[model samples]
Target chain A: MEKNRNRVIIASIVIGIVLVVNILPFLWLVLTSLKTRLDIFAIPPKFIFDPTLKNYVSAFTKRDFLPMFYNSLIIAVSSTLLSLVVGTLGAYSLARFKIFGDKHISFWILSTRMFPPIVLVIPFFIMATQMGLHDSRFLMVIVYTTFNLPFVVWIMRSFFEDLPFDLEKAAMVDGYSRWDAFWKVALPLSAPGLFTTAILCFIFSWNEFLFANVLTAANAKTVPVGIRGLVTSRAIEWGEIAAVGTLQVLPVLIFTFAAQRYIIRGLTLGAVKG
Target chain B: MARVILQNAWKKYGKVEAVKGINLEIKDGEFVSLLGPSGCGKTSTLRMIAGLEAITSGEIYFDDQLVNNLDPGERNIAMAFESYALYPPMTVYENIAFPLHAAKLPETEIKERVGRIAEILELTDVLNKYPRGLSGGHQQRISLARALVRDADVYLLDEPISHLDTKMRNRMRAELKRIHSELQKTMIYVTHDQIEALAMADRIVVMNFGVIQQIGSPQEIYFQPQNLFTADFVGEPPMNFIDCRVKIGQGTLLISFDDSVFKLQNKEKVEKVANFENHEAQDFVLGVRPFYFGISKSITDSERETNFLRGEIFAVEPLGDSKIVHVKSGKNHLLVEADSRFMGQPDETIFLIPDAGHLHLFHKKTEEALF
Candidate 1:
């Protein structure tokens, strides 16, 4: 009985430590966002400081706030939708069919995500300039797609992997063409998986900094770029930064929470077929 | 409605041949099961017929028309998946109605078709429910209904009812057989379970290592097994094999194992085993069914020269319909099924006689049948 009690206490302590480790950073972010300037920079750190919405107001007003929000929204939603459509199809083929250049194709796709974004940004900047597509939301959408497409294919391929090919065949025999079968039978069945990948792609596009800063000038600067440009010599505008950062991170946090089940499932789908 | 014929079909995965050259004829309205163990190419053969898998070489024909390169849609073959792939987002009614809707049928006709299929599959009440809300068995029924909702030339079921519970599997097997009879369309079923294969198949195509081992009626395969594999694979408790050698005599052949010798009833049939003895003399395994063995007291001693053996009972199992008695004779274990009323005791000395007519001789080297 003593041994069992000791084990139970140890397990609870370990669990508590783990829970605190995961939640502490998020707690700090929320607290800092709510704290006033004096309390935020208090000598020993203020644990029970009075909270205010001033930082949020400062953040939104100081950054070209609505445009930044709009830019991020447009880029995230458009790129996510585009990648979902193209990536689902590409992933289906990767999971199901035999392509002529399968090795080069898959390797090329995966390599897009492996190289440092800075390396691609140079060529991307030149190409966009040459093509007369600079600071344009359209160019950003396309760039974000390139950034997210590989991940979309890689993740969604695993989702498609969990499904049986017989469903498509069954649909075909039921008087549907291959395209029809994919659209009707396979697509709807794989919605949760697609939703997960879509959310991931959207979040990645929303939070991107290097490309957003390099490519956009004024009209198309997303939230991340806008927040990073908030540095000043006289005052650093901590409250505004926090508020805008909250705006920048909230959708992703909500999306991550909303689609977490499918994300976990998508991660496991690659191994679950067996 | 159609006959599916595979003429020298092949499927090669890189250098590993999953399905070798094979010819099969699935007659219209025939439920032919491709029965084999895992990795035996049974599912590959079914997939080839369904056009889901591309044949590496040779031709597939539907009603004498070559359909080798045709897509699954063109082949018009309905199939049920083992995973029970139902659209998670769609209602059961919408799912079942999808095929008909794709055909560009009128709304009323689609509704009628969906209703009829739902009724048949007992999924009528759950028509508005999504697949996630349904039980596994109900999902299976919905999957099957979705497959059957469309009018296809052939129904290719790949382990359709394998995942159901014992009671449900048996019930679904009977239902499938009934559906085949009612529809009168070419039906090719594939399964690894011998009971399911035997229960629903008009003919069983036994495959092994990408090759067709045997193709015959269920009874033929059950009784006249082509090889030791079939004998072992087709039975409930499975056919028992005993290592024995044949000793020649004057006019009559003697099969000897340890201190026992049994006379062959059909000299001509046993003579066919002469070819195997030349090469597989030391590699011979005699196959016998459980029901073929009887106690010496049950018959006259003088007439027991056919296949009688002296052994002692090691264990007795009462299985309601029959009693399975384990015999330990000359360092070998043998299974003998006797009447449920068998008054036998463990460790009792008994003379067991195997029916010569039911005994199968096999070449252990190639695991092929000798007689």
Candidate 2:
């Protein structure tokens, strides 16, 4: 019992260290955003300074933060939804049928993710510019889909494979058509996997920087790109930057907590059965 | 209410042939069992009949109508998988009701049907519970109930109770037999268990290595097996075979095995042994069940019993109802089912009398029973 108690103490201390390491940056961001300009640059990094909402006011009023946040939301939601629809069908096909060259096709879809995003930014830039879609939110949604499709397919295919084929066969034997079996039986059982894949896809699309920076200019600039705009040549608005960073993290934090159960299941790739 | 027939049906998965040209005729309302060891194409045959698998050649007829091109739904067949493939997301009530709903039955009729089957299976209390929370036997009964809810032409059960505990399996076997009699539906059961096949089937189609070995009533398969596989596969503590040499003597044929000679008095038994003489080899195999072999404490009446084999008891297995005394004579071993009260020590000399009336003869090379 003493040994177990010591082990628990050691484990708790380790966990405390990890929690501090992860949460410290966000805490600092929040604290810095609330500091006045005089307190932000104080020599001792004032721990007991008076907090202010001046930075939030400047970020919203002077920098157009709300529009950029909206832009990020629309792109993330649209791309995640689109990828899920197309990817689920592709996954079901890969799981159920004996299509010719299916293995190669699945590998090919996954290989699209192997190339660094920076390499494709130029081609995408050229195409977007040529098509007059350079500053369009629709264009960003399309680009985000290209990145999320393979991930959704791979994850959902595993979920479908984890389901017993007999369920669908039994459904068919019980007077259902093939499509009905998929819609009613296979789809509902994969609810956990679907939620997990959707969250991951949304997170990736929400936090993406390289393409969002290169593709969007003024009208379609996402929050990540907008945060970089705060870094002007003359002077950096440290308070506003800190405020925007904290604000940018709010949705993701809320999303993680809201669907924490499914996120764990998704991260383990459905290896934890049910 | 359909008569199912398979004519020269075959299934091929790439280069591997799973079912090699099986032909069968199942009468209306008959409970036929497809019995075999694993990889014996029994499941393949059942799947083909259900239209879950495509036949590579020949035709399947349901009531004289060719159903080779039909899907499982179009063929009007219901199957209960061994895995108890209950829809995990649905309640027991919805899982059973899914088929009737798919067939677009009226709401009142669907409710009535699901309720009746659920009550019969004793799943009424847990009607709202998901299958994953149910016990294995309950899940199996729910699967059966789901299949039974529909008025399909035939019901195909693929080892539905093979995974249950021994006691539950026996109880479920009895329930299945009772259900078959009450419903009077055409059911095709696939299982590797011999006892299940013998207990429930009206007729059994025994298969091995992707071919149907024999189709016969349980009695025929038990007592009059047409082939060696059927004789060996059906019985518990299976039939013992002894190699014997044939000797033609004074208008009677004497079969000799390990210093034991038995005269074939019956004309049928004599003709079966005599027919083996047409082949060059005179060696033949004689098969006898353990129940037919008698065991005695000593050989006091040796002169009266000519069919007695001399051996020492190798081992004794005391079953609750009876005992199996294993006797070893020279190179051969025989199992004798004696009364439970009968006691014998290991290595004690025991006299075994092979009842000539129950002996079966087969050609040594062909393995085909002569009678």
Candidate 3:
């Protein structure tokens, strides 16, 4: 009993340290976003100052951040949906059928994501320019979808593989076609995995900067690029940056917390035998 | 409702031949069991019949209609998977009702069927519960209910009760047999348990490796196995195989094991040995079930003139109804069933005489039954 208590104390301490370390920067950003310009630059960092919404007001009004937020939402959601639809079908096929060169095909799909984004950014820019699709939200969606597809396919494939093929077989024997078996039985059973994969795809497309930075500008500028624009040549608009950063992190936080239950279950889905 | 037939059906996975060319026919309303150990292609054959697996070659028919290219849905079959395979998200009721819904049945009819099956399987109380939290037996019953609730032409069950505890397994075996009789639908059951196959099936198709070893009624499979695999696989405590040489002397057939010789008194058996080629002395395997052997504590001088062979007891296991005595005669170790009250000690000399009418002779090399 005594040893277990001591072990519990040590574990709690480690967990507390990790929580503080991870949350500290985000907490500071939220605090700074609510502070006056002078309070943000205060010595020793003002932890308990009277907060103001002036930074948020300016970031939304003078900088036209709302439209950029809309653009980010559109691109992130569209790209995530597109990736999931195509990748899930591909994953189901790869999981169930004995396709020739399956191992090579899966590895090749994953290899696309291994290439550093910088390596392909220039080529993508040139292609977008040549096709007269530069700086459009459509182009940004396509780019994000291409990058996110491989991750979706790889993760969903394992989820599909973990499901007993017997479930689909049972469904088929119960008078369902192969397609119905996949859609009705396999897909519903994999809800936790789908929820987890969607959240990851959304976050990846939402927070992505390098490709969004190079591929989009002006009308299609996402929140990340819009925040980068606030770092002017003369002086860094720290208050506005912090305000937009808090706003940017808010949706992802809400999305993750809303799906937190499924995410936890999904991560540990196949750990136990049925 | 359908007579199922397999015409030289085969299944191959890449380079591995899972099911060799096999021909079988199941009459309408017949309950046939495919019995074998793991990797023996019983499950594969069931899947092929269900149309869940495409045959690598040859054909399958349902009621004389070719179903080789049909999807499982089109084949109009229902199957309970060995893995249970209950949909995790659905309640037991929905899982059972899923096939009916797929068939586009009326809501009232679907509810009626699901409720009936759930009640029959003793799952009514858990019908609202999801499959994930249920006991294994409950989940298994739900899988069975799902298959039986459907109005398919044939019902296939793959090791449905194999995972249940012994008591539940026995109960479910009787329950399944009762259901088969009530519904009178053609049922194909796959299992590795010989007891289940023997108790439940009208006909048992015993398989080994990827080929059919024998297909016969339980009595036939137990008493008159056509080959070594069937004989060895079917019986509990198994048949004891004694290596013996059949020597024809005068008008009698002398079956000798080591230095001990037993006279074959049955004229029909003597004729079988005589007709099994014209060799003077031929090696044959003598198979005797443990129950068929009569053991005596002391052999009379007159009994030695009969077919009694002598052996020393290796061990004795006293079951309630009978005692299994392990006897060592020279190099052979044989089990003989004796009366439970008969107290026999290890290393005690005993005389065992097999029933002459129940003897099985198999050719040594070919392993085929001689009678």
TM-score of 2: 0.95
lDDT of 3 by residue, A103-213 (tens): 999999999989778999999999999999999999999999998899889988998998888888888887788899999988877777888889999999899999889
lDDT of 1 by residue, B224-334 (tens): 998988899998778878887875566465677787777774768656765444743566788889888777445565756456777888998889998888888887898
- DockQ for model 1 equals 0.40
Clashes of 3: 0
For residue A206, model 2's alpha carbon misses the true position, in angstroms, by 0.9
Ranking by TM-score: 3, 2, 1
Candidate 3, residue A21: the lDDT equals 100
Candidate 3 residue lDDT tens string, B132-191: 888888888999999999998899999999889999998999999999999999999999
When superposed on Cα atoms, how far off is each prediction in RMSD? 4.7, 2.2, 1.6
Give the chain B TM-score achieved by candidate 1.
0.93
lDDT of residue B181 for candidate 3: 94
Q: List the residue pairs that clash in candidate 3.
A: none
Question: What is chain B's TM-score across the candidates, in the order shown?
Answer: 0.93, 0.96, 0.96
lDDT of 1 by residue, A1-274 (tens): 9999999999999999999999886677777889988887887877797789987876666546887898899988999999988988999999888888986888899998887889988898999889989899999999999988999898778767777676676677677888987887677667778877888788788889999899989978888887777777687766677777766778888888877776665333332232
Q: What's the ranking of the predictions by DockQ, best on top? A: 3, 2, 1
True lDDT of residue B26, candidate 1: 83
Candidate 2 CA-lDDT value = 0.88
DockQ for the candidates, in order = 0.40, 0.55, 0.67
